[model samples]
Target: MTKPDLAKRPDDVSSMFDRVSRGYDLTNDVLSLGVTPYWRMRARRAIDPHPGQQVLDVACGTGTVTRILADHGSTVTGLDFSHGMIEEAIKRHGDHPNITFQQGDATQLPFDDNTFDVTTVSFGIRNVQEPKRALAEMLRVTKPGGKILVCEFSHPTNGLVNFGYDTYMNVLMPGIVKLVSSDPEAYDYLFNTIQAWPEQATFASWLREVGYEQVAHRNLTYGIVALHRGTKPAA
Candidate 1:
């Protein structure tokens, strides 16, 4: 499920998200059965960002994880290609000086080599047309020994669970999205991408191949969600 080399490029996906930005978070909460926030908290746990540390959250749609990580004591910069999402993030969290939202690309992050103490991308990598390139950028910005945390909807292993989740995402969620956002088709695409995401083993191997060492993953909620973690070695 590598997405068939999507004709929609990275910028196209970004634009699609921007168009649906207003209702995006709400849609996630409803569609995922209010578990998306719990997933974010778990992703932060995987990264284990510390006080006074600098962390970057890529594809930070409305900065849920960004603000959460900031509150945990790290100075966080939330980057997204969608201006609308960034605007919403600022509108919601601008009162916190530790959290800053900016417009940036995931595959081509606007940061120097080895700059961040940690980096995290929650439910974002699947939207990138070039996921490997974004992963490389994430590794490039992470300081030696720093962790890269990724939370994604990995394809379920259990047949029964997968069937139920797919029913929710593919069958039930579309109707919900239609009422929530004008671009219901975008949410449909999102569901399709989730189904098409690479399995956990392949993704962990990909992370190691991209130069992230100590790769590991943990399943959540009966394989409906997963958190993958890796670290760059100090030279």
Candidate 2:
């Protein structure tokens, strides 16, 4: 029942996620019309993690993408601000020797500089109260020449598609969430954040501003989602 406002106060956001931790992954699948997994696949491909790589998955809810990264033989750390979400992730993936779940703030990652070979967040950064700071943190933790990929809901580029997608988000999604989500009001916050998120190009600029180089993005699902990629400059 608890929902955070657009201000995105960390405690409020964390508590809201905790309230919705139960069935959260299933709710995402239903709300995204089963396309959530595909989006994650695209993100993983962008990073292309390898054996012995250290990858950090920020705001990893239930360790879905974390497990996907682990499947590639990478050692993945799944971090989330919500304790309940971390608990769910550990419950689901605790046995995976390659994956570890931790509760931490995105803006202040609890890791040493240049620690990870790759850092990524799927459908999570927009929830951070200070996304720019979080991006900087991601950049800070990534080793020189390492990569970062962000997969998030984005605005459609084509007019017709945009119209249809807007209608679906504004008109159809609310009703669907009410029916399927364990905490329906939390999705109201979700809708607001998606609407308020920056467009693809602008978001890519955030990575550039945070010192990532070779930044670029590709639209997926008619730009209803976008995957942004960047690399840390070699020291």
Candidate 3:
């Protein structure tokens, strides 16, 4: 099956997520075998969240990455376009004074320029209708000299592993998602989207094209996931 073009108009993008909001996290964990949390841990370490820094966690479904950033002493504002997802994140993480959950579109953020010390997104960029535009917004909100960090899925370069990984994601993962979620095809689209996502180097170059400096990327778990980072230029 061909991958769905996730980069589309706002209305189409919004509707896809509204349907998946109920089972996004559960399907993610099942597909990743509960290792998505560890992937986020590596992303948190790479970003080096610090005290007094304000961070934005874009597409912060269920506040997974938001809570991690908060635990590292950074003030985190988690945003998602899906109202149900944002409400879930708020219910889960909003009690903490350091973490705020809100509904916002990635292509059009609500904050002013350089409003945050760091901006991060986990497993969300691929779903954005305009990834380049969304990345630009991330750069816009991040102060000069701060970080724009990302953690997302990527296919393996190793041929043998790629074959096995594809089998698992396309076959077994969907079965599991079906068991856990009524929205079974939503996870299927996730598999499709990740497979269609650009390579790690391609994404890093996209960040550079969006005006991010010091861009770097590291593949984790044999290339099933990748963590990328870019820093805003200091004046």
Candidate 4:
């Protein structure tokens, strides 16, 4: 039941993810109330992966979104800080010719500058100790004019929906996680982080501040989740 604190120390967060890797995907599916697939679909659509593109899926737990990008014809690399998560990803997707998994840090990506046509992270950026550093790294790796997308839990815009979502996260989700998650304390960390995360507009501003252009966000499920996109300046 290891759990990372709000400060999000890299070692503790990585170990926490490792502890939950065995049932990570399943638990996420359950916790997301079966909307995980829809979220992935929205993310894929936003990315619009195609042949001849080099796509990087950062913190790609279990390689789920990475596999989707590969299916759409991109050569995809799924990178995660958690070795256990990377192991699970390889176990599930090693046979895919278009996909590769690597264990790496987000703040300092392993690849060279201008290496990827598109870089994305879904439900992972918030776990980074310095989210802006990761965003900058993603920008550095992306080709000029390339795309960057992040899909994460976000604050709801509508007051009524916000209240309901808050109620669910603060009240209902704890009991549900205790029942289904192997490491319930990890999910407790998840809840806390989600609660503390910046809103969609604020996070989009972070992307802009990190040198991404054309930054925008689309709210989903009444803003319980937000998909943010940006482009590396061509010049």
Least accurate stretch of 10 residues (summed lDDT) in model 1? 1-10
Compose the digit string of candidate 4's lDDT tens values, residues 1-235: 3359899999999999888998998989998889999999999999999999999999998899999999999999999999999999999998999998999999999999999999999999999999999999999999999999999999889999988888888899999999999888898899999989998889988999999999999999989999999999996
Better of 3 and 4 by TM-score: 4
Candidate 3 vs. true structure, TM-score: 0.93
**Candidate 3 vs candidate 4, lDDT winner:** 4
Candidate 1 local lDDT, 1-235, one digit each (tens): 1222345576667777777788788878887778887888778777676787999999999888998898888999999998888888888897897887889989899999999988989888988878999999999999999989899888777899888887877678878888777777787687678767898999999899999998999998877888998999886
Top of the candidates by lDDT: 4
Q: Is candidate 1 or candidate 3 better by TM-score?
A: 1
Decreasing TM-score order of the candidates: 4, 2, 1, 3
- Model 4: number of clashes? 0
- Candidate 1, clashing residue pairs? none
Distance (Å) between predicted and true CA of 220, model 1?
A: 1.1
Please list all clashing residue pairs in model 2, or write none if there are none: none
Better of 1 and 3 by lDDT: 1
Residue-wise lDDT of candidate 2 within 114-177, one digit each (tens)? 9999999999999999999999999999999999999999998999998988898889998999
By lDDT: ranked, best first: 4, 2, 1, 3
- Compute each candidate's TM-score over C-alphas: 0.94, 0.97, 0.93, 0.98
lDDT of the candidates, in the order given: 0.85, 0.92, 0.84, 0.94
Could you tell me the lDDT of residue 209 within candidate 4?
A: 96
The TM-score of candidate 4 is 0.98
